[model samples]
Target: MMFENTLAFARKLDAEDPLKNYREQFYIPQQNGKEVIYFCGNSLGLQPKSVRKLVEEELEKWQNLAVEGHFTGDNPWFTYHKQFKEPVARLVGALPHEVIVMNNLTTNLHLMLVSFYQPSGKRIKIITEKGAFPSDQYALESQVRYHGHNPDEVIIELAPREGECTLRTEDIISTIEQHSQELALVMMGGLNYYTGQVFDMQAITDAGHKAGAYVGFDLAHAAGNIMLDLHAWQVDFAVWCTYKYLNSSPGGVAGAFIHEKHAANTQLPRFAGWWGHREEERFQMKKGFIPIYGADGWQLANAPILLMAAHKAALAIFDEVGMEAVSRKSKKLTGYLEYMLKSNPVMEKRIQIITPENPAERGSQLSLLVKEGGKQLFEAISAAGVIADWREPNAIRVAPAPLYNSFEEVFRFHEILSGHLR
Candidate 1:
């Protein structure tokens, strides 16, 4: 891919892109009444233009069918969620029954924890990474208390070794091995939200099983950003939100995966609701919670149709452009971003690229460790019309999504950011 100038790299890539046309499907944001270089898709993704039609279809069905909308809508309110099964399953590499569209990410995480994190006396500890998203940390804390266990005592948070930006695979496996008897669950993020370091799920799963512990992940950053095979990896369960790399909008619907091995066992205790009951027996006003098989049984309420429609729109593009293709482009796009950042004098020495250098170990997002004028730098970048995220003290997250973000936008970010350097 030859380019005449730095800004032309994006044009060349776009010309060769198979899924380039899908970029037009979204509603891009404007800063000065012109489209800004949008590199924040890892935080809140751009919206799909087809969302209105999808929502309107539901609206029409609601007004016409009224009470009958449950079974009569274009997609049908009753099984609107089911229409998404195949696409969602394909995204995470799972069987249809192993996945379900429902609730928000944090809510689904709590629900999954209820069924999967069953701790007993002595074997009551949970193993997770330090500085996980606050919601996951909170849920795990409350869950531990709910089980009459102390989170501080029961939750073992693994930290990176001195001077290391990310956790080592060996350290995680060793932690599981050392705590095998005491550790009941290895619940952690599939990718660190701050570092953009993707965990070795297969290795983690193998180690957890060896320790007689169940392994699961919060795939909020990993879901659409990386390729995963939950079943093949031997992961017991996983949860993810659609709003990030999935491009489904903020607080969008979430989904989960429960391995087939656990699907048939009725022994797993769940915090269930009427919606989780079998379809045939649900209308009987069932007495006992006759749970639906697999991941569907994790649901705790009626499906949110509007939210699911947004997810459906996002999944359509994902299905059209397979993860293999998406991930391949992602590596080059992100590698270019890293290359540009490193080329800068101060940013290279002062700011750290916390994300793994290996393309296979990361996604679209790069977490930059800004220094000195960190807050000022983040605010300056945003004012310059480059949409990036600032996390707490000194990190800025910039993701150039393959579907919509351009390499030219990345050059503009460099131009904007370089001007602010000392």
Candidate 2:
């Protein structure tokens, strides 16, 4: 498809977009009196208009039913988390029993590590990408320390080749192969937060298993942004936050996936709570922690109803439209953003796109490596009604969310950006 730089052309594309109407579902932020072009979905998505209504229903149930709300309400609090099984599983291409909406991403990551990261004699090392999200890095460091191992010795950080912005799949697979004898676990962000590079999860999972190690992904950026098949890929486990592409409210309740193979293993070590006990036996309040059948067994507490309400409201949109359609528009929208950025000769000299050029290897985000005054440029765009993200040192990250962002807004962004290139 030929992409033209003209606003008229952008409007034509938006006019033709099948998902354009869905934009009305969300409340876009405003600057002064005008709506801003939001490109920060990678950081936090805009609120869905339906959120308030859903949340109010839950509040009404609590007020009307009191303690009986657990069993009496429309969406009973007793089994609230169960409703998401089908939709969340469908969203990430996993079996319903393999997925659970529960605690936040890092907490779930710790639970996954407890079960999967069983380091043993001679196999005490864990492999992960260099510059992982700080939460992951901290979690790995603390976990290693808990097990009486030095983080420097137990954790192997794989880096991109010098001058390259992202890791090559070959390099990642070879790194797993190189330390096969000592590798206990392989964990990484499914889509890198900074570079916006989507890793080959299937390849990485296969390589990790071949090396006799467990594989997991921190899907904080991947879950709703890209098409994932954790079950098909045989990833041991995965976790993701909902506030970004899933568009739940701020710090929304998160989700986790455990392949049926692992989820069914009741004997697997996990930090369990009463909510994870078998439903039939839960009220009995017995001594032994007899786990539930699958991913539900990993839950540490009862659902946070309000947060889950927001999540449910947000996921309904995905359930209606489907991930395949969402992914298609994401590729086209992000591609247009890249094309618009690269079309200018001045930008060629001033900015470098650090994200993978191949649509298959990236999500909606494109990280621009500004040659100079990157933060100042980011502030300029922000001041002109563009809500983008800036990471330390240089890059300005922009994500044209397919769910709400329009092609015309992307063009407007390019126009605003071009004005400040000097």
Candidate 3:
């Protein structure tokens, strides 16, 4: 499909977009009485209009029902997390019992590591991307130390070849095979946050299993932005935050997935908590910890009702629209952004799209590496009301979220950016 770099053409696409009406459901940021061209959903998604009412309902329950809110309210706090099991499972392609809405991303990562990052006898090393999100790096390092091993020796960080922006699938597979004997775990971000590259998770999981290692992904960026199949791919475990593309509020409750094979193993080691105890025996309050079946077994505490309410609101949209439609619009929306950027002769010469061009290898984001004036260019865009993200060293990342962002907005961004170039 040919794309034209004009406002009329952009509006034409928007007019035909099936997902255009969904944009009205979100509150786009305002700048000087006008809506800014928001492309920062990858960092923090816009709030859903339904969030206020849902959150207030929880607050009302707390205010009126008091202690009885746990057992008597419309949405009982005791079973709030259970409501997300089906929708969240559908979002990530997992069995209903295999998913849980829980603590923040890093916390869930630590909890998963406690169970899956077992280093025994000769198998001690963990394989991960070199520039994984800082939290993941810290978590892996601390986990290795907790196991009485040196991180430098027990962790293998994969890097791209010279001058390459992303890791190749072959290189990743080869590295896993090369250290197959000692590799105990293979943990990586499902999508690179900085470069916007989507890794081949299925292939990676297969390779890890072949090498006698447990494989998992930190799906902070990939969860809502791309399609995933944790169960079908046989991923041992995975975790992600809802504040990004999921459009839950800031630092909202995150999600986790454990394969049925791992989740059903109630004896699996974990940092046991009372909430994770079996429901039938929970009130009995026995001495021994008998974990509830599936991913809920890893829960360290009870639900944060307010946060989960926000999450419930967000997931309803995903449930209504479905990830299949979201991903389909994402390809066309992001592709058009790339085309519009490249259409600018000045931008073509001065900026580089470091993200993979293939639609399958990326999501909504396109990381622009400005050949010169990187910071200044980012500042210029920001001043002009473009809500994009800036990474250190040299990159401006923009993600046109399919759920809310429109083609007209992407075209407007191009116009603003081209003006700055001129």
Candidate with the greatest lDDT versus the true structure: 3
In model 1, what is the error at residue 415, expressed in angstroms? 1.1
Q: 313-420, model 2: which lDDT tens digit per residue?
A: 999999999999999999999999999989999999999999999999999899999999899999999999999999987999999999999999999999999999
Candidate 1 lDDT over 205-293, as tens digits, reads 99999899889999999998999999899899999999989988789988889999988777888888888888788888958887888
Worst 10 residues of 1 by lDDT: 1-10
The candidates, ranked best first by TM-score, are: 2, 3, 1
Looking at model 2, report the run of 10 residues with the lowest lDDT sum: 262-271
lDDT score, candidate 1, position 129: 97
**lDDT score for candidate 1 against the true structure:** 0.86
TM-score of 1: 0.97
Clash counts per candidate, in order, are 0, 0, 0
Provide the lowest-lDDT 10-residue window in model 3. Answer: 261-270
> What's the TM-score of every candidate structure?
0.97, 0.99, 0.99
lDDT of each model, Cα atoms only?
0.86, 0.93, 0.94
Taking the tens digit of each residue's C-alpha lDDT, what string does model 3 give over 105-186? 9999999999999899999999999999999999999999999999999999999999999999999999999999999999
Task: At residue 179, give the lDDT of candidate 2.
Answer: 99
- What's the lDDT of the predicted structure labeled candidate 2? 0.93
